[model samples]
Target: MTVIDSATENVAHTESEGGIISWVRPKRVDVDLVIPVYNEEEELDDSVRLLASYLLGRTNEFGAPVADGTRAAFTWNIVIADNASTDFTWAIAAKLCEDFPGFIRAIHLDEKGRGRALKTAWGQSQARVVAYMDVDLSTSLANLDDLILPLLGNQADLAIGSRLLPQSRIRRSIKREFISRSYNLLLRTYCQARFHDAQCGFKALRLETARKLLPLIQDDAWFFDTELLLLAQYQGLRLREIPVRWVEDAGSTVDIFDTAVKDLQGMARTRRTLNSLSSEGTGEKENARAKTGANATAKAGAGASANPAPALLPDFRGALIPRKLSYTV
Candidate 1:
């Protein structure tokens, strides 16, 4: 969690009239889209340039009524989180930061763990909406609107890309497809989980929701996503699942068998924890269940642009950089 590069300036906190302190976050961006990499030197450069260009509006050919049809211009930046890549991934990320400056920032961690990288980056981010996608860009970039707009509009606390949905258009091998379905099925049968496709690698959350949920996560790897989703449900956070167009690239470096074993172990641990929580209930207010994938006819033209404005909550705030963490794995 070392501050490799402070791409943002820490703004001063301003107070309101009734003495309710407002923590105007250090880097007040609309969204912080984080891409965490372990050893992805080969794919890093092209992916960054591609995604950066889209963010800069260079390749945004599709602004037509996607994701609730709320077309509002908001600020966003990308964070290249390198989690101790043994290859040249770190060097490439640093160079990209130099190339893009404020829009593209890079951070380095001494250890390797996807969850650790995401937690470090998301914890530091005070962006109105914090999001992440895999570097491979397996999911459609157009779906970003679906994943992010709800959080911006306060429609849901968390949103995830789901390849398992019937509306999803995915090109994947039989083995991977089987593995994913089986894994999620196990969660549903054994853990009574409702949300689907926890391993889709595309998700977003409001900064306030992330702030309250992050500290409860323990896994430092792939299981982080599932663990976070489970805890979010336990806390009664509204979760939305959006169907996505995904193409599974064969060049993925993930070790499926090894990851599966580890994931099973993580599931066991998580289930035990959930059981304990069930036995000891809390007296917190229940969260409202969100209706996902609703079809509403958004105003066709410019009228729809101003429909749901991006509203940044008043209390969400954090430091300029994530604090250093202590891990033993």
Candidate 2:
């Protein structure tokens, strides 16, 4: 097999893998695709190896017009973020990291939320773009580049695979399809969200945007994706919705009703939070205007500067602090 090296040259895997391994062990990366897993020991090895192989091939297809009109190729890495799995998932992940060297790495978290795992792994990464997908590989691997292109081209701040899009091809049960549509309908009605799908497991974001917004996301569970999307919309960030090919995996562990109840509650809470912020912002603006009016009155004829600068909005960056995440490849 041939793999693209750091220099963008195609070389046999055995020849280039070790050299790139040495170079990337301590350097920044172009893309980091995280797979957040919890007690998925049975699927760990196959899924990780498949993803790694796909990404290795993906690098050879890059080098088009990316950010700033520069011809850049993607040097991608896979991160397996294990969320406190009681099973042998962590052991398998560590072995995969060791086997792939610089091409793959693993992080073990003490908590059991997929969101928590992604939060830590992405925060610790120095990659330009960060992404995550389900371990079941329900979404087609062919759409990976499509999900990433908008961010890479600087055309959008976030990219999401939308199984709800009209062009999306899905092989799911009628019950699941109904539930998905209903959930997205609620998002549109309650949050006034514009994106087609928020619950899709396939998603990516620019690292800068992730850093700025991940702090404000309050949910540390299944609602994490929804919360992140809602916050991004509230912040006026651009989103690219790509229609994806999806296949529902059999023997899935998710409880639809339980997750739906939690999601609805999360939606309500997010709406309240956004409304509160808006009210606070309005109050701050009014106070600033009042002070400005007072100053203008006092200096009416003293040749004061005609225009005063507007007050800056509150900074929410401190909401979540990034920890020193440990990883071993």
Candidate 3:
């Protein structure tokens, strides 16, 4: 459980000679687009380029034009969360950052896994709105406006692109489709989760809401989304699900059997954790015990004082702060 502080100051230093600008202090933005990658070198470049081009032509929902474009006004930053790729993914990402200036930036991590990468990137970024999508772009960049619109309008705390809803169009093998349907059915029945899709990788969240819930997620793999959704529901957050067009990429890395088993196990884990917490008053006693353990550990460190204050964990069960845990799984 590593705690990261993201509220650093933003300072900009300019070099007059070459029109170069460097961020001397941490820079915050309106939106942070987090793309967690494993071995997505094949389609990474095209996906990023497309997103950059689209972002450059949009508006910020204030009905004002952005960058002289005919579209609505919007400002965003794309953060590529590199998950220890073994190919040229990092190099290509670096090149894109170099070529695009402030529109794109790449953060590299030696650890590999979707959840690990996303957690690291989200913790590091300083955006009001934080989002992540699949590297394959299966959800299509065209629907990005729909996902962000709810957040912009304050109608939703989190918005997810759903592929199993009435308005969604999915092109895939019948077997794969059946597996998806079956998984969703199981999730609803066992987990009591209300969302149509709990596994779709295209999702956006307000940074405040995300900060409240992301730390509660325990799974660091494909089941990360499920844990997030379940925790959000437990906390009574407002999550909006919107249908979107999605296609199965030819070289997708999804393994039906393995992923299904893992997802089920994760679901059971979630059920158990929630049940335990509910039974013991949202596990407050357990949390206190954990804090005491942490304090003891901290005291054992070299040159450490015996009476250190217990670090405060973010409370996800608060009232006024709606924990919008919405997503298209």
TM-score of each: 0.76, 0.78, 0.75
Q: TM-score of model 1 relative to the true fold?
A: 0.76
Candidate 1 lDDT, tens digit per residue, 61-171?
Answer: 232223333332668888888888899988787678666656776667777899998998898787999999999999888788788888899888899999998999999
lDDT of 2 by residue, 1-329 (tens): 12323343323243333111211234677788899888999888988877776665532212222233312247878888878889998779767866777787776777778788888878878988999999988998778878887788888888889998779999999999999999998777666667778899999999999999899988888999998987787676778888889999886888899999999999878877876766676678567666766446656523334643222233333221111111110
The runs of at least 3 residues in candidate 2 whose Cα sits more than 4 Å from the true structure, single-residue gaps closed, are 1-24, 58-73, 294-329
**Residue pairs that clash (backbone atoms under 3 angstroms), model 2:** none
Model 1 lDDT on a 0 to 1 scale: 0.74
* Off by more than 4 A, model 1: 1-26, 60-72, 282-329
lDDT of each: 0.74, 0.74, 0.71
- Tell me, by TM-score, which candidate is best: 2
Question: 1 or 3, which is superior by lDDT?
Answer: 1
Whole-model lDDT, model 3: 0.71
Q: How close is candidate 2 to the true structure, as a TM-score?
A: 0.78
Query: Clashes in model 3: which pairs?
Result: 59-72, 59-73, 59-74, 60-73, 60-74, 197-329, 198-329, 199-329, 200-329
On the 0 to 100 scale, the lDDT of residue 264 in model 3 is 93
